[model samples]
Target: MSGVFQRISSIWREFCKRRAYGALIHPDGIAAQAEELARLADLALRSTAALSALECRHLAQLAQSMRQLRETAHSPEFCRLSADRRLALHRQLLTAREKLLASLQKTQISTEKLQ
Candidate 1:
């Protein structure tokens, strides 16, 4: 009986975690992320004269990924993902955004140095 209770408690905790994760990756959250990414990309492009070939390629790839993310966020399939899976997707999006921004910042600083 005690073991059964423990198992039930564990399951409940897992369910709650999933729900929280789902909320984090909800459409609204994705939309907000997409908007931020677009803003960042625009800023990077505005400084194209300071960017290297590699930086430009990275920005281009980032733009493509952002477009895909926007499309996925609007798709019915994305809406149906399990909360656990949604959390994973959210993390990936965040990581990608961070990397892109960091790369752009590094390029910007390097360009400024040449001035």
Candidate 2:
């Protein structure tokens, strides 16, 4: 099983447990995790990993999308979404980039903080 799937499973388990604790399950929780798992499956199927500069660009794009989505967190649209959904979606996208980037230290260059 892919790491994404494993993470999704972990998230689902936590979600279920939350519900058992009387917590409401966000309708979009599964969708977000499913999207993440699908993304990983797509990557594995294509066999294109962080091995190339293209993958680096792809990861960067994913990071930018995540940032934009997060910026929307304070928007009314974000408020409309369930809290679980927002957290799950953020976790999926961020974890995807983190896992992929962990594999390529050369490409995993970090920028210095500027004043």
Candidate 3:
């Protein structure tokens, strides 16, 4: 029974790894993620009230990352990039997107509380 459980866990890990790789490296995947991240950042910047110093810095960093991701992923040189490089960029975009979302939610919650 223990052996069976170990096998299942191993299989699950492999599946997740492959899925993550494929999803990020597929033809349209990287570009789409970059666009989504940009949209989120824009929304957060436009809708939020006064941000903290840390939030402002984070938002600046996220904007820079989004621009870099867009340029790299869409460049003619992108096709020559290694799978690892593309995957890393995709991960960065995803992380930025999540952070922007969280920031936006926090701002909204605070605004509501003040109301």
Best by lDDT: 1
Tens digits of lDDT, candidate 1, 34-53 = 76786788668766567667
Q: Estimated TM-score per prediction?
A: 0.67, 0.39, 0.60
Superposed model 1: Cα runs more than 4 Å off: 1-15, 109-115
lDDT of 2 by residue, 23-91 (tens): 223334433444454455344434443346665566556545544554554567755654456556656
lDDT of 2 at 48: 40
lDDT of each: 0.74, 0.52, 0.70
Off by over 4 Å in 3: 1-20, 52-61, 109-115
**After TM-score superposition, what is the CA distance of residue 88 in candidate 1 from its true location, in Å?**
1.1
Number of backbone-clashing residue pairs for each candidate, in the order shown: 0, 0, 0
- The CA lDDT at 2 in model 3 is 100
